[model samples]
Target: MSEETPVLSLPLIQPSQAQKHVTHNEALMRLDALVQAVVLTRDSISPPSDPDAGECHIVPSAATGVWSGQDHALAYFDGTAWQFLAARPGWRVYVLSDLQTVFWDGSAWTGETASFQNLNGVGIGTNSDSTNRLAVSSEASLLSHDGAGHQLKINKSAAADTASLLFQTGWSGRAEMGTAGDDAFAIKVSADGAAWHTALSFDPGTGLATGDAVQTSATDTSAGRLMRADFGYGPGNVLGAVSESAGVPTGAVIERASTVNGDYIRFADGTQICQFNASLSYISAGLCSAVWTFPAGFVSGSTPQVQGTLNSDSLAASAPSVTVAGLTGMTISGLGATSVTLNVNALASASFGSGESVDLGVLAIGRWY
Candidate 1:
């Protein structure tokens, strides 16, 4: 009942039509132009001055000249003039100039991309080289995940090879981190890319670290090195060693250890004290004397500060001096580095002074080392 097809609007011949060949030929012309449609371009707004017969293009927006008011329509040229055909939603056409296939989605033409499941290389805006197969010249790149999490992993086949991320400045490596060599986790840096210095490294087997950042030796007093407990002094072994260098002690910060030398106690700081108790016998009615041998402290031929105290209870006399008794103090004489002599003279109650005996305590302080 209608004059043309509903979808393509091609002229339809009706029964009893006078010139059926004219209408049928017109339908055939429409088929020749639209089927397997191919176009020179999809973005040109101006009609070509010398378009050949059967030359086609998708008229762009703001079209001028003969293509005016035919935006987004397929413009096909016949031998005589140009014809504008309304496009459907799913019409696909190959664009020769862009070397791509595009589809009509009602308003404009969009690229018709094929599946890229197993492409050998994909260079977005640059040429793909053999080594860098998927090269892209971009300001930034993003590899995000579908929803939750994402990870970018790099792997290597052998331990001797590197698997790491390198940071660079001006295409020269400045730092690198990860397992670099021999299965060890390492962080290395370089001012110049050729020579690398390991700032931090971890041994995979023992989990111990070794690098310029760690302090592994005992005598490392340099700056910017971490002090290890076993390799340096700490609370457990504060008195690590004893050395007086440049008239200043280098080790043993406090008094935690001491050396015993017979009656002498020697300290790590070079201080020694000699403490002893002695018994004296009277040689005369008012005199008593005792010989003392020095302990191992107090360097040879050194005089030390000496002090003595007598046991007061022993000075009492049973003779009672016929009523009460008294005695004078003691004296130190014949002093030497290794020995000393002490004498006590008692003048009170001479009758009871003879054979008098008493106990004495002595102390001496000096340096040992």
Candidate 2:
């Protein structure tokens, strides 16, 4: 009836009451070895040849020697013999040999590091919650480094597989940049996820960029060239004139006729303009005539202005009333969009005499858009 009696089982009465202390002391010794005991091993059937006192082990099936027929029992070495304690569910034991914590779960003992199920959150060196399921709030995070320069790779199943990092808004993709379906590095954007536009791409083989209608190779057919800004300027500032270069000239002024389809390059000073020029020769047995065709066709609804000087090779004794007849002898008899005609004769006299040749230096001013 004393407190030294076993909690679960009472010792049998011996022949003498004086030896009750022996039974009580034995039960207390077993309780001291089993309570909060650290076992050296589990499922060990064979007894150690040299077990230290107070060392414990979980009895295995078909155990031999003192542990025989005591499977799943906590066995303790009390230096003289083995003491057994029945294991129940939720009993925990620390294995000193393996430095692991193990517990009995109704059926069997399992290690603490084994896989778990239905965990809400897990944190390493911190506490986690439902929002952050697996949070590791640390200064730096590392992955797959085994003592050398390491590369973090995101591999796909095949060559035509898409492997990219997509930035999303509300779980919808906005932009993606990576090797999507190819080896070339590409950056693509999308307003809606269904249709995507490639903004830029860099070819790994050629080291060239292709986008924005810019040519990537020197042998391309189009006459496209790179344009670079001279410098940055403030807003609302007027740009200076650019000199003529391999491309179109900057600060160029153009003028179109009001009544015609003629466009011309008009300069700032208006001193020089683009014009058509021609020289005509005429044989004079009567009124000499010649026609000039424009090199570039003139614009419709425009009449070209013609001016010239005429030279006559004839001087005769029977000269006309006007001795100097050549200066005032030429006239623009006809004019059209594409051609002009000039008439040459002796001024206020008969037609130019036989064997006289007339030369006219003519100029036409007009526009052909």
Candidate 3:
């Protein structure tokens, strides 16, 4: 048998030897230093001069006085002098100064949490709650990266389920920015923690955003809102029929009517332009007139501007090369909201065109309201 223990190396009492009680007492003194050890400190370089009995310390490197040469060993005062036991791997002690348990992990003393895996419901500086699972009460917390980068992600179970980060003041919710109440990302705010306002939200597919604080219609002049584009347009929107009372656009940007008699084009700014065609006979010599009724009337009280040009059918080398277009004067008369009369003065010479196909293209501009 060995003279000392194989584990703790406690001195064994010699067989049939005198002073066996001294060896047994030495072993008991080593036991008193270990076994649920509570160390004063692990930074002591020397033994204390007035240490109490059974007081233990971890002797550091290059220990001075009575602890000289006993580096990294557990030292305890045994009433007369100090006793030491060499430290080993897996040796544990509760440090009074740090108020934590440390263990010698074959290389150095490390905190009990130096290596841990798969621990859940672990609270730091607070208690973990049922729903929270891992609650923390602190002024601030840090989650640093191991080498290059870090990402904090919150996932949800379904599209309708909420996955969000809520900010609170005095246990009352104040603001939040995350995918809340749905898969879309949203930012919501609350003044009294009871009523909430969705300040912004984004679509998952199109990445478009919509909110009450955003300017929707193109003509919206409200302040304190972000300018935004409408999600839908065309005939259902700015291209639709004119409706001044509609809150979207004041009226259609542009509207057109293709009629057999009169073709008209209307603009949003209340301007309407219409066209008409006329074929007059030159058999009536001096002043011939034709009245054209507009396909659409202008806003009453507004007289439309009328102008026309004659595209003569037969220009068989007429006299007076200066008036080659057959007619001397074309003027507008009796202008009104819905119709106007075009007067033409035929040439005095008998160079009358035989056909009534004296086509005249006329245009009128006025307000359509």
Candidate 4:
């Protein structure tokens, strides 16, 4: 017999040897449809009323008509009637309705593809070279969008669960950022992965940022301030200080000798306290008093303490009775806002001669505003 003709393991019986080929041909017709078979549908249990010739189906259990009692058998439609073939293990068939190839695995049909394991790389839409494994090249790749807006959530199992993205250098962790524990977002960096510094953190509950050297508030109320600039001792410096100009300190507070000939303490709020010393020389002999101008922003009615030393040997050795010249008996006698008068009675009861001078040192303490 030719390859197209099916050879059956059956005795050929014929009346007068005429109908022998008829039965052989009938068996061959069934084999033609069953070999390398394809099925239009697999889910329908009921046989169609008008199945065309060579059309086949997997006969479901309790099927009616010619398909009855032939569950899971290949039922092929010959030109005249239906024919059944028992399916064996590894019987492969293409299911046209599902557009997939299924195979019988001794008991049931499965659609699993052949095994592919331990590949060096696999690329979709692009060529995969040796450097990558399972590379998918696309303009963009989206994930987990079933319906509405989607969120790619990296969730942890508990409050102490670490869900973070770690950046590495030569397989050693350099930095990491995410929710390491609890719901707070944190960013940490490390020279070595074992010791990490939390550089920044954000609290979800309070909406505040906090960390080792970072803060997000104006005041320190358990939380720290927003900004803090620090300086450390540099070359030849006794202490750390910040300066906007070379050799000049322009910080919130500065203590320095004034270039305009005085000593001053200045605050960030524009308040200054100054002290100075001066020599009051007499214009002529018999001079007993002199008025000194007060520093700017001096408070009226506030007495400035004054002490003096005689510039010449013009009086007896005794402390002069010093007072504000206008206000009798008061050391800071004429206590005006801008100036004050000093009455210096040398020798206890007498005045000094011409060209006599007194070196006066005054300290006025008050606020600017």
Candidate 5:
């Protein structure tokens, strides 16, 4: 105080303010006092307690905590009141406060009675060996686990009929409706229950009626479970029109399509068997000049068997007459002789003789598919 200045000689400072030099000196002295009193305060401060030595009441779980004891010897305060947490090993109990206890029957903590007092949802239990588990409540759902996946049951109510189970197997069967007295048919198949391939197709009006057994192929029989069945009508408005053609090709009848002259006959088979040209001048009268014998043992059916052309031996012929053969498989059963002649229309005056020559044309055959 003797070395300091007078209180009235200071510059205009606030009433609650102190001088900077005085404040600095006061802080230094306090620091020095504190350093000098550290030894005395050392005895006053006790050593820090060990953190991991007691029955931990509020321990944060790094892993699961195992509670095992026989008689009620331990107590814990769960931020509220002191209560006994567990008792003995085969006989266990947890005092969860307010006269409530959680009892365990060698397995899990269960209520003495089904008390809905603090129950949030439902209760679950396991069998004696704990291999199977069951859950109980007023309205219960199911859950199954096989260490691979988990499934849950959901209760739903609707006016419409919906899909109950959506399980995918190797195969599925379906019955598609058609016209009354129509046949049932198989439509498609699937391998993994997604992509489908058509297995069988039926013609319109070719389906089996209701209650009829559907016939399957050897391929379908072997691939039993991995197959599927469906039914549909034929394309367009036609019903069951499935008709399979013969496996073999059959010969059809040929009709006359074109002609060069009336004398020459052309058939639809594309075979130009005969020709009518302005050659071999004959008498200008259309007549059978001479009587020639007709061939014996000639028969006709669906097809022509023996084809022959009669050369007008009586006169020079102008046009060649054509005859188609019969069915190839048919045999000439009873023939009178090898040389059978027929009547011809030609120049009978002086240019020709009787029964000169005859020729057979290309023979046609029948084929079956």
Candidate 6:
């Protein structure tokens, strides 16, 4: 047996690509006479578990061919058969149960999906819609919660490079400042910390021209303060400074005065704006932000009075009770007898008859018509 070394013979290893099993002698003799005259189709094609007959839920060598129950369930895998692996490699886990649809690689679980009923439940923000549901957090700013709290915040980072959005009606709170033309704004307003009301301001007079906004409507809220400030400047001429926080009231002031009701302030082409002063009560920078509206039948006196006399003689009834400050509501026409009209509490005395009372003091009033 020492010289029998010539019995060494090895040559049998094929399969580069030879998989051609074509058997159809009339479809395998009509499937072997219909599987031997069928007994429930030969026990339903037998093999449900039979790793070479050792059986034990066999179907794992990865999965050995020809065992179709519509093609494997539970552990999935059903592409129309042909799978065999008998285990031994990464704990085999094939799941293809009609893999409805899938796809996602932002991190993990990506069989590429779009169906499978939207394969939910598994990782990375799961799936969100409303603008990505606030996207992401960790102090990069912008946060919100509606389950009842978290309020609201949006400050990716800003202390004063420009930050604002305050709107509260009745209790007072309004700040509006946003410009991109001519550019110049400095407005202020506040309450508790002890008065601050630098209300309306806008400056951008020159060529780049586009800056004009000043709005305030504080129709008495008893005492609780009001606020509204705006400031923006960047068009070259740059000269903007109007600062006051609380109820607002610091230095340079003249925030509002544009009386228009039969408007008046005439100097035509010279820059002193305001017009329509019928009886003239406008004493420039003197006092009287706005007042002058009398044309009805003014004969109602007392804190809300209006009396008119002196129909002609160039107008001069000369102060009697002298209280008629501005006529906006009471309209008094020429009273009978011989000229007797007086409206104070806002003073209104037009004259002509002087009917000889001589006291230049009027007190004969009584006309409801």
lDDT of each: 0.76, 0.63, 0.76, 0.61, 0.29, 0.29
Q: Considering TM-score, where higher is better, how would the candidates rank from best to worst?
A: 3, 1, 4, 2, 5, 6
* Candidate 6 to truth, TM: 0.18
Off by over 4 Å in 1: 1-118, 143-147, 232-369
Determine which window of 10 residues in candidate 4 has minimal summed lDDT.
321-330
Off by over 4 Å in 5: 1-72, 77-301, 304-369
TM-scores for the candidates = 0.46, 0.37, 0.61, 0.43, 0.19, 0.18
Residues 301-354 of candidate 3 have per-residue lDDT tens digits of: 998888887665433332122244456657877888988877766666534443
- Give candidate 2 regions above 4 Å deviation: 1-16, 113-369
On TM-score, the leading prediction is 3
**lDDT tens digits, residues 1-369, model 6?**
231122211122234524323222223332332221211111123344422211112222233335543222112122233222222212212233422222223222223324545543323334545544422324444457778678543342432343334434564764433221213444544554235344444555732222122323322333333322332223321322222344342212221123433222211111112222233222222221223342221224412222333222322343232223332322334443222232222323422122211111112222211
Q: What residue pairs are clashing in model 1?
A: none
Candidate 5 local lDDT, 1-369, one digit each (tens) = 333224212223334665866555544433332222111111112212322222222111131222222122233322233323332333323332323344435444444565566443343542222321333434556567888898554334532323232323533532222222223233544456656544444444655322213324212344233322322122331222122233211122222222332122222232322222211222223222222122211123222232333333422232333111211111222222221222223233312232332222222222211
lDDT of 5 at 94: 32
Superior by lDDT: candidate 1 or candidate 2: 1
Q: For candidate 6, which ten residues in a row score worst on lDDT?
A: 34-43
Residue pairs with backbone overlap in model 4: 284-354, 285-353, 285-354, 324-333
Candidate 2 lDDT over 1-369, as tens digits, reads: 444334434354466578788777677667676577689888678988888888889887888987888888888887788878777677788988778988888777788876667788889889888876776869987787689778867788876898888887887999999899898888888898878877778898986767543444423335543321222122322233322233333333333221131222333222112233333333554555667665445567677676766433333332232245443556886687777777665654445554444555566676443
lDDT of 3: 0.76
Over 135-177, each residue of candidate 4 has an lDDT whose tens digit, in order, gives 6869987787678878767789987899888888887999999
Return whichever of 1 and 5 wins on TM-score.
1
